[model samples]
Target: MSGYLFAILAAAACVAAFAGVYRARAIGAVATTGPLKAHSRPIYHGLNAAIWTAVPAFVVLLLWLAFQNSIIDQFVIGAVPGSETMESSARSLMTSEIRQVAAGNIFRQPTPEVQAAADHLRSLQAVSTYLLVAVTLAIAAIGAFLGMKVVSARYRARHSVETAVTIFMMFSSLVAIIITLGIIGSLVFEAMHFFAKVPVTEFIFGLRWEPQIAIRADQVAGQGAFGVLPVLYGTFLISGIAMLVAVPTGILSAIYLAEYAHPRFRAVVKPLLEILAGVPTVVYGFFAVLTVAPAIRAIGTAIGIPSSPNSALATGLVMGVMIIPFISSLSDDAFSAVPRAMRDGSLALGATKGETIRKVLLPAALPGIIGGVLLALSRAVGETMIVVMAAGLIAKITANPFDAVTTVTVQIVTLLIGDSEFDNPKTLAAFALGLVLFIVTLILNLIALRTVRKYREKY
Candidate 1:
């Protein structure tokens, strides 16, 4: 039903645009008898009319759709017998069941009262949808009439259309800002709840990271430690190892592709390299678990170094291989963006090819390369599936790459598994960890932006 509303809106906008052009053309025909003409093109007038026809009614339709479900739930739940006396959770469950029945998802027999309530709910929804369609179409008609009234010989339809488009673009850009704020707000909100139960100092500075607490208020359980250092160290350790593996390799490959390889070879190699990014992270995890981890363990045993089967080394190496394309693709573009004249001038000044690439080309492309590296670093920090599959569940501060360690994301997943009661510190800790991760990623992004702005070379 809601889908049909979108179709109707689109059809109405198209019709309004055509009708507006027709009206403008008619006005032009009348004006040909005098020394008057349209101030704007017929297309501009049509676009303005389409905006007028769609915007107001679309806004109303969205508001109606957003609130209609909750409003219907309130009315329908009241019709359910004993709903008034049920606890909030029970009432919510009953409401869900009623909705399921109304949506034709019932798999078992419903009680007579529930069946009756479902019927009533369906009836109300049908009436509401019909009313919505009528009101929306009526508002659209009124808007079309208003728009057509302004379409005359000397109307500034172009200005009106431009203003409307500018506002739409501004809103489109604001959507990202709005989403960022919403994410930060949600993390902070839930994190504050966690902090209320556990001290911020303890969570941030304490060394242990056990996160066990009572699942229910009446149950007694051990008060778990909320130290984040172990996971933080593990995150950095794995990311550091990944950077070690990825940076030199990725940058070298980028340099080769951009400066050394023939054009045909570069084209073939770059696409094959980028194909790594398209390979799913789960496949990388599987590779780490089945292939990489075992090889590392075998090598460790042969060399007298004890290593866990799920070592950080294995995880980091596979993660590095996974992000190789992200770095190579970006770095290749960056190196290629350095003007050809710069390289030619270096050669003309009696510099070797290696020296030109090393000193001149690298410095010119440094900003973009740094930006790519940092973004890849950010990617490494946020990865979870590979960590979950290959890294240990145990969180411990360790310097050894061969040690089994966990990350913030892995810990968050561990703590939030199954049906978690968010009131407990055990579950709430995940939000705090998430807040920490979010801050780290945000910092990386800020640094990348600053670096790009500070030294970005323009050719």
Candidate 2:
């Protein structure tokens, strides 16, 4: 049976077990009414039984599935002929072929020994599946029996259920932390490999970025530069331009919507403005490439100014438009969160609406506005498609917005594409870029948090 089918059966068994246990508990509670008063509700008893039936069985199933492939492969390798004489790479290839043959996805003629091993693998997998089903169902049955036996009037079913729920929540939170740690660890490991090949200082401070290097000793091309500053410069330049366009326009729009606009108008306008955020970044990229870039170039040329077909100006402008809704929505919420009593008191003190808003509402909302801007800035920095389509991939340090330049994210994407040789610096450089990007973003988040906390405390 398929793993998914097994999962369904396991779930069904748990449900059936829970239903029987709950019915028995409910009947028992009503039958006796003396010093043995029911300590917890029938629902809690049912929930506790369900948790016991499912959790252990699911945990075992997950662990078995995680290690099943590796164990099966090891057994298959031991049985395959000439396996001990094969190199690591050759063994990996053979394993792939065996899996393909076993699954009936074979693309090439297999030797008799390989075919025999494949058949054996299929048999092993079938037996393993049967064992998994039996074991999981047995566990669920045992847990359900124990749970039902313990469901007396004095049993703390609510406490047990609540404890299980608390543990599950903690596990869920830990998963996120584990995933973040895994990402950082992977990046640092691969980045260390990259730095072993290229100097860290050169990668950080050098002004050029050309990661393509000759693979063969006889090749004529020299080792390409791995400088990161030019890419960082381009990222900052474009993001700065985007912030310039997004911040004022979004804040003003938010101010109008939150403070001045009629409720009916706000209802109509807010969703319309937020629609920009829902539009895919790729769509913004296409707009920039097909329309904005061309228009900018033509206008620049007509005015006797130089402009690239794919320039920072085009990408930044489109990115700014894309980020506007994020800023506007967040800022609107921030502005709306200010106390109405404060607004009323300011007006009662003879201050004009505009003056009250400027002196009172803006100050109160500044932290949230700053937070929204920071978030918008992060979105602009991490953006890939819009920059890739509208900004040409040339790593150069220049202040001119009309010039073509590339970002760190674009470079990371380029370096990782179709390059499987992790031993090479060219592929590993992607991790180096990723690490730097993560650090920069972390710093931004820290600053934003600190600023928000300070203002929040003062307010």
Candidate 3:
């Protein structure tokens, strides 16, 4: 049987078993009133039984699925004539071919050895399916029987169920934490390898970034520079421009919507504003390239100013437009969260509407506002599609918005594209760029968290 079919059968069996056990226990508790008065509800007894039946069977199923392929491959390899003499890579390739033949996905006719191995694989898979079904059902039945045996008045089924659920939740949380740690660990480890080849100082402080190393000895441009400052500068330059556009406009729009707009107008305007957030970044990239870039170039030419066809200004402007809804929606919530009483008090004390908003509501909502802006800044910094499509790939350390520039994310994408050898510095440098970006983003988040906490405590 397929895993999903088995899972469905197991779940149904557990449910039916739990229902029967719960009904019997409840009837028993009711019949013997004094000493056997139920300590927990019938639902708790049922849940406890269900958990016992499902958890163990699921764990066994998972372990089997995890190791089944490798175990079967080993058996297939041993059965194939002369397979033991093959190198590991050759064995792996043969194993893959056997699987392809078994699945009938082979592009060419298989040799007799491979055909024999494929037949054996199919037989093993058939046997394994029967065994999986038998073992899973047997374990579920045994677990259900044991769980039902313990169902009594003083069993504390509720406590047992709650503890199990709590443990499961903690495990789920730890899984997330471990996954995040794994990502960081991988990035750091690869980045360390990169740093060993290219000095940390040169990568961080050097001005040029030419990571194209020649694969052939006779190829020109063999020496590749690993400087990161140019990309970093471009990232900050674009992000800064985006924030400058987003912050004031979003905050003011939020303030107007929260404090002044009519209810109907607010309802309509809010969704329209938030719709910008839902639009894909790729769409924004197209807008930047087809519309914004040309307009800026035309205007710059008319005004006697030089503008690159692929300029930071065009990308940053479009990116800022994309981030507006993030800042506005979040800041709107923050502003709306400020108590009406505070606003009334400010007004009663002879403050103008604008003054009351500026001094009372905005100040009260500053923490959330700052948090929202920081989040928007992160969004702007991490944007890839817009930068890739609109901002040119030339990494230059210029403050002028009209100059072509690139970001760390864009460079990372460029470096890792196609079939890349991980050992090469060109590819490893992507991880190095990723590590720095991760660190920078982490630091920003830490600062935002600290600021939010301090102000939350004060408020």
What lDDT tens digits, residue by residue, belong to model 1 across residues 1-459?
Answer: 778887888899999999999999899888878899779888988988898998999999999999999999999998777889999999898888888998899899998988888999999999999999999999998988888889998999999999998998999989989998998999999999999999999999999998887557766556789999999999999998899999999999999999889999997999999999899999999999999999999998888887898999999999999888878888999998888899999999999999998889887898878877987898899899999899878899877678799998888888889998788899999999999998888787787778777776555
TM-score per prediction, in order, is 0.89, 0.93, 0.90
Winning candidate number (TM-score)? 2
Ranking by lDDT: 1, 3, 2
Give each model's whole-structure lDDT. Answer: 0.90, 0.88, 0.88
Model 1 pairs in collision:
none
Error of 3 at 54 (Å): 1.8
Winning model by lDDT: 1
User: Which residue runs of candidate 1 sit more than 4 Å off their true CA positions?
Assistant: 25-34, 74-120, 214-221, 449-459
Tell me the lDDT of candidate 1. 0.90
Clashing pairs in 3: none
Rate residue 179 of model 2 by lDDT.
Answer: 97
lDDT of 3 by residue, 266-357 (tens): 99999999999999999999999999999988888888888899999999899999999989999999998898888889899999999998
